[model samples]
Target: MRQDTEGLLVRLESDKDGILSIDRYGFIQGINPVMAAMLGYGASELEDKPVRLLLPDMDEDLQGDEWRAFFDSRIERHHDHLLEFVSAEGSLIRLDVQMFTGDGLQGGMTLLCRDMTLHLGAQESVFRQREQLSAIYTHATDAILLVDRRGYIENSNPVASELLGLSHRRDGPFFIDDVLRIKNHHDAWVYPFSQALIQERPVVVTDDIQLVLPGRSAIPVSVTASPVRDRSNRITGCVIVLRTTSESRRVSTRLSWHESHDPLTQLANRRQIENEIFRAIDHAHIDDTTHIFLYIDLHNFSVINETCGHGAGDELLRQLGRMLQEEMVNQDVVARIGNDEFAILLWDRQPEAVMDEAERILQRITAFSIPWRNRRLKVGASIGVELINADSTSEIDVLLSAGAACAAAKAAGRNKINYPSPERDSPSRASLSQWTVRISEALDENRFVVYCQPIVPVKAQRDTQHYEVLVRMVDPAGNIISPGKFIPVAETSGLIDDIDRWVFERLFTTLEALPSEVRTGYSFSVNLSGGTISDEKFRDYVVNRFAGSSLEPGLIQFEITETAAVSHFESALAFINALKAYGCAFSLDDFGSGQSSFNYLKQLPVDYLKIDGSFVRRMEVGEVEYSMVSTINHLAHIMGLATIAECVENQSQMALLEEIGVDYVQGFLISTPVPLNTLF
Candidate 1:
């Protein structure tokens, strides 16, 4: 027995687990080399030392009987537990410990400990990796799903639920067959997920594949299926990804169509027609062939457009385009070139045939009518024919000849055909017409800004400020343009009302943002075009804006030229009376520039008159100019109205205006126009 006991002790000393024995008084009676080395000490140094040196948590005041009770308690309560110890080098050691007390060799206690720090650290690292993978799955852009070995859905991301139309509240052990159904080009089932699982490789389908839901339309997608493998190289499941391609395809097709076709009429547009003309010119030069180009302008079209709405005009144009297309041959091209205008090109036709075709188009347009509301609207066309022969110049010359011929036809009579020579048909006004696009673009891009020049009272006035609000446009190159360059074109193209609205909206909105005292103290003089003053809608818009503004009624004063007021006399009077009833003011600008300025003054209810700059600038030199200014000022005072002299440049002009008793003076002598932002 003694020999057996000695062999057991030798075996225990060589074991990997650390072992120690302590007496009831808490002294280390015996310790194996393993335990001593773990604590960074030798067996001789620790064997006789108190156990409390290693276990700092143990109380040092315990006596022999107290130590006996403590050992007993540790054996019962802390068996097979985790505890911490301080090494001799002041490092931490975490261990899984077991205690034995009754059969201990020293009649105290025995400890067996295994280090657990490395094992627990490895577990925490694996947990973090799983969390990162879960985040990727949940937030991926493409729809993704994970399947199990038995073909059942183990998990899915949020995109998968949305793409497949699955409800999160549903209870299920969902199978891959029920959740993901794919169809090939022939409407036959395609099991990419099952194939990926069986072959242990990725399967991708980019075309002619659709995902079918139970009650919704099938979605076109590019699908990819990849097998999920374990560490042991065995297939466990598959990942399915779906990316949509429907919207991209639709956008591409729409863009391709709009490149050559008009959005309103679905016919060839001007760009397409120009390309065809170039091709025709090239063919004519090579083979000496002839092509006939016809420019068609519809008459009385604006009558329907303005009387009935623009929708009616658009419908009429569409109907006319269809009729014109019916008259063309296979190689012929028909296109809408402008508002209420269409062009047709007939290839390889003689001069007589072209004339007959133009006549037929005239009769066809005159006969066609469209029904709107309770009435039928009919229109006539004036056709201009240009024969393109081998001697025909460039495409631009051909278009110019056609346009000039059309102008001659309109000048003669309605529903007529004319082929006037380009040189005699009145030079092309295209240069002036191009300003329409520039002005429209400036308004759309918000490139216009307000500028103001002070209107100083010649004599000292109290609590009153006045300025003339001017408009300037900023081009794409950052250059400022004066109104004289574009205003004539805007008036001719019926765009002056739009310009007026733009200026009024910007000025009124800015004024509303200022303090009440500032807004009420100043009066702004805004210019009004003849078209704007005649428009009932513009008048209503002004009234509504004034009703909503916080400014005083007298804050905005309208300035109109004598010619504008005289041209639209009745409408101007009504417009003035409507706003004048609302406590607004009006000024007659360029008073003596018109032929009958004084004759119309008796009928006009104005508060101020501005002498024309032409007379004001030469007043210091010419007696006639000076006499005109004095007479106008005397007449304005007699009618109980104030007079403002414009173009007052030098002290001589200012002194002349003061001698004439003018109420206000505005010119370069006072100040040039500055941006509104700076003054405010």
Candidate 2:
């Protein structure tokens, strides 16, 4: 029995197939003679080494989650696949691998492998015996050639002759390698057929392979070669296949050009420019490189396109593309992304340089005009320059910053170059600066007037009512300007406190003129700003002015924004307490709009929590909004505060708010804000 077991062991070790044992950590524990010989290493040298010494990219795969789970669960697994190994000579060797989980035997695995060259020879032998392949070879679109072992062509198809421009050559005079001219992308000669026949091995040549004719353009094609052998395993000849790639190559070239170039302007397109931006971002991340992205708007280009003909507009766009190309340096890229919208990309360019270039473009555009029929069409340019760096948040953030800066330039009357300051300049901020001067002038001339909107109770049984006082401005031409237009400016420029005082004084005078029954029947609400809340002088001035008037605090409700209140926590707390002591009520306007949490609601002495218009206006159409409104209402009720829904535009929104147990609603549905004189 011992002699029989030893003989069996000897036969197993002597087998041509490879076998190896791997520890739980993928170390080579034991290697059979065949595996050691195949790996070009002695048995003692391979043992106790990492398996990755042969298959470097395979170590992670062997210890992958799925592989680990197989072993931990004690689930036996069998898989047959091809594994590639980098041999000592730095050439890839593919083997048919049969791997299995070792049934948790010491928490390890087993691998069996065989070189696929022998299996391929057998498959080719079977393929050669199939008589049907003869017809297939004759009808195939690719060129096929049969050459004998002595390097003489035996048979050829029509395509094989045509591929090499040898359609007129007889079979006896034309040798396959002599008649064909092949080169690689680098224009170096490549003899895949000759080399394959000499080496008695297969070869595949790709990547810009070309076939040259005597007096025509070189055709792009790929060459594949395989050695043919007889059943006795002797090299007989070779089969060379040629595949023309011109059709696919032509299609690919056209598609690639179209993707990266704008058809209209013949410049880089949006996708291509975006790729440039991505590269710039990657460069910035690596070495803190800075770049500039300029958003350009051809001011009133649309009007020119509409007034003049489309042909005239096309001429102007083409001129603009050419003009920009000539104006920019070699490293700069200009793109037309949409109608009348263009972008300029500059890497590592200074802000001052960008500003100078933008100014030159603007000056040139302002001076240059195109003749359209009998009239000359001219337009200005507004460019917004944003300095991009690693500190500029994200790619989209910087892009939006540039867009806002461009919009601000346009808003500031156009024909200008605007670089975003460290502090961003939004369109609203531009309007704020413009209105600041106008607001000061209006205050000097008393152009500010008061408007009021009625707030109605959601429940019909409740009869309490209040009117919110809103402010408007009258221009020199006597046009009534909406509060929405100037209030943002007032708050931003520290004019809200003055405006608040102006509204307070006007209300007192108006109340005194009205009959007592008018004041007794209804109360009034007024919106206040954070500037007024934190101003001690404004608070004292209001106290003294109101104490002297016939206006009782009970007839007034002061409204403050949630964001403003949170910003001036200490001041807001003191102001609310002082106002409440005077028999007045306070409401937190636009309550849920800011990041301030409802957890602070217990500390704020507010009589009302006004839900923001964004959630209230869309509550009927959005389920999440309805649920949100319901939640805010429930929380407000728990805190013993009434809720008012803003921007209740239609009956559906009204009905939803009422269903949610809201106390009141103030929006256009109930009344549009109008001059106080209209009320009288």
Candidate 3:
């Protein structure tokens, strides 16, 4: 372990931030390679040095009541105190320091320091952008065309130049009417600039205001013309804003069907779909025909983008689009509305036919595979269906209903078809919007921490205490925040993998700081998020950690939830095999929670099966639950694997687990989670 520590220290010597320890008397007792480098001193040269060597404002001997007062007021679990230091090059360096008081009252503090140069730089950049917005807004993508009172073009921004097809024209005077072919609601040709200037008010055009191009077809744009005022409030010119509008954003406007298809999938975009819906609604009202709108979303497709690459994700989407086209009739319309999301409009209103098509599409997606770099990747999809008839509301209402149904399906678990009910609450969307900011802020501030929970053997085993590393967040006020409060938020936002990485890095740093007995004696079971399990970069990081660490690989164990493993079986197996090369053990955590747990367990080479805490906590109350625990325990042992019971909160529960041949147990009854410092 000492050998590994030395190697890791050497590897970490180039860290951008500094790390040091300060004694009770404000003496710098020890510093890591990073702090030494930051201060331009050898690691040994900084040992047992007075803190005044770094902080000149401090007295040579900062002891007595002064030191006592500092401890009483300054000691905290988490501190965001800032300090300025003269760097090795004699330049002022501002440092953001997070300090945690060490084990004892008189003990020193461990400081994790980060340089604030880059953060300050980003702030300055934002400030500069805000200050210069007026000068830069003209170059923005929004088209701005300036026309004089005579309806002749006076000036135009670059965006307008592209939109008006004027990029190829030389410098010359142009008339607004000659440039744009504007048709109004009365189906009469009108000049927006002339109208706005004559009326002294804005003249908006949402109808067909198509920009005529040289030797090409016209593209529709929403035109807004307002009189540009001078100092006396006199009309100096008419400013025309030309924005390209999709059929969905248009006000009762329709476009040619072939004009709005997504180029990649040759399927309709949102614009075309909107047009189709409008036509269908009119037809339904007149002919009494009915329809079913299906909103489909691909599950875990983001995993492909995160692991294999976005190119692979796009390819998978294309494949699914082709399959949908093959399964649908000519009357049915499909659109690639958003990323990994599609909408299909079924012409028939029969509930049975609509469901049959939906199921067929689901099956095709489930069985479909994409060729990603020489490997075949799997896919899953969820669907929501909304039936529409002659009595159905507007196109927008039906679209929203279809969306709600799709959301309900995903909430129930992906790869299933669901219909939205009037009473079912949809909180997943709200949770995502509320937690994204908080989770992002937590990550940026490095507010996450690792806590170790003791996992003791049900029977006599090693005296060394094994632990499962759990994650916790340290709020700004220095209070401990539970994982249950933020974990689901992180997972929903695809940020759980980031949190998992933070946990591992923190746990690894703590482990490297411990003595060989305390470090190597304990076996660690770190939780792996499903997102991380599917990420190639995560796999690489884990492999690199093992390559650099001095401890035996067997000492490090990984615990992946059963549901995650089964859902992404191929990816999980590949990840397990990669880490197994380094001798790291694996545990299938939360086992017996899934419908196909045993079936997938037969395929996994896991060393342990951790029974779900729900079963262990409730087994004593229900015979069925108790039988489940016994059956899982026996089956695991039969498969040459040990069992660990979670949430064992009493001696009776522990005794029951031992009687059932469970190998280990973890809960408040045995030990609660403690800081890594205390564990060591």
Candidate 4:
């Protein structure tokens, strides 16, 4: 028995686990090297030492004889316990300990210990991750649902219950499709979760998705489903997230409406009318249909705006907009194009029928009145009807023709419909059609020529010669058509910008071809159209031209009409500033022509202000005209801008402009617009 006990002790010393033995007196009788190392001591140091040194809080009942008896009672039986000990590093450590009782002969207790520190740390980390997931799942905003492999609802967030109208008293787990029904825009049922589960990937439904509710109206929603996976990388179920999108859709719809309609009257605005006109022109071309375009100009309306305030005018316009809509058929279109101007598109109508409709609308507008603050407000409309057919060149042409007819009606007398007389208007229409072709041909064949009229200094001797550049087209018959006849046609046909670019390039090329000495002593001003000012491509072209040219930027000036600059104020300002940075100058040509000329003058960074020829022409005849020119010149000087008087046809006009402190004068008297070569 002693030999057997010695063999067992030797084997225990070689064991990987820690081992220790205590005597009846509770002293460490022996300890294996593993157990001594675990306690941060040598085997010899712990031998014969009290076990209470390792376990400081040993129970009083577990001391001396009691401890021996307690351990001996479970002899030949296995027992386990968790014990805590302090290492030499002053750190607390846990151990899984197995104990065995020795017989009376041995009279001691033996313990086997295994370190459990790493296992406990792993378990704690897992517990913390679970808690974080629980919090996120509970507090999510979008409706979230978890499903099983069979598409059964396994779990759901609070939002899911409320959003899907789920009942708290539901008996058991239900299928996802049984609880929620989703449809697409075409009224076809959509099953995003099923798709995700089958395809083992994410599925999204965003195109006009609607969630149908029991006994309630359907609501718009966006849904996404992602497949959930198990440890083996096999799809187990799906996670569905749904978000309501009705409010967002509503906002988008409202923005689209505002883009195409006027806010005050909820009627189509000018841009929408232009689109409709384009469509009408297309229809006319395809079907040889004749449409009527009515340009309605309200006369005597400004009287209400002046006497009763703009509020009354606004109310009147709103009423007029609604009345126009009421008088039109479903296929007909009406739009508000200007302050007191409205346009109506009569689709696919005979000429006689369109004429009759125009007459009726004219009478209705003339008789229309509204009561406002103890007074009845009345206004009249002049309606001009133009025919839209396969012969129509463009929307602008149709609009201009209608506008011209309206002006003629106003000139004839207001409150009537001016039907274009076939006999009188056909030649004008034919001329317009011919001019469209002619302009294109001219641009292609280089039939356009540049002319220059001198702009002479009024007060100072000229250091550099100044000229206002002009353009003329030589027709196939060798006839020079005045700008008054073709410029309007060019403008309406959308060829004005082309003409502008042609003039600029031609002038530049011609001047660059001139003798350097001759060109360096002169400055040229080129006119820019409204369309050109608004065109970004044209702006880039100008910049590139200037960058590539050898001409001096200071000698090249751009002239934009007052109305054109004011109409496209932002584009004009940007264009002007861009060129001005390159050392070029700008002139607000035909100044005092727009109603808000002075208001915009302060904002426009111009080097020159050209008084409108109408004002300059009559400055000699009337005080009002004379004051207009003088006031313009005075204001221009106040803003540090030079003033040029246009249409100085006589010496008297030049003398008057000089008296007004004008800096320059250009007209027939200065020099009839001569050929570019003649200027040398």
**Best model number under TM-score:** 4
Model 2: per-residue Cα lDDT over 241-285, one tens digit each:
888787774454345556776766767777777677776777778
Q: Candidate 3 clash total?
A: 0
lDDT of 4 at 140: 58
Q: How would you encode candidate 4's per-residue C-alpha lDDT over 150-201 as one tens digit per residue?
A: 9998888656765665523346577899877999988899999889987889
Taking every candidate in turn, the Cα RMSD to the unseen true structure, in Å, is 34.5, 27.6, 26.9, 31.2
Could you tell me the lDDT of residue 324 within candidate 1? Answer: 82
TM-score for each predicted model, relative to the true structure:
0.41, 0.41, 0.48, 0.50
lDDT of 4 at 394: 77
Backbone atom clashes (below 3 Å) for every candidate: 0, 0, 0, 0
CA lDDT, every model vs. true structure = 0.77, 0.73, 0.74, 0.79
User: 403-476 in candidate 3: lDDT tens per residue?
Assistant: 65776788688698986444532544324444556777888999887888988887677766678989888788
Q: Mark the regions of model 2 whose C-alpha exceeds 4 Å error after superposition.
A: 1-349, 352-432, 462-464
RMSD of candidate 2 to the truth, in angstroms, is 27.6
Model 4 off-target regions past 4 Å? 1-291, 295-330, 333-344, 348-384, 388-400, 406-426
Q: In candidate 3, which residue pairs get closer than 3 Å at backbone N, Cα or C atoms, i.e. clash?
A: none
Is 2 or 4 the stronger prediction by lDDT?
4
Of 1 and 4, which scores higher on TM-score? 4
> Which residue pairs collide in model 1, if any?
none
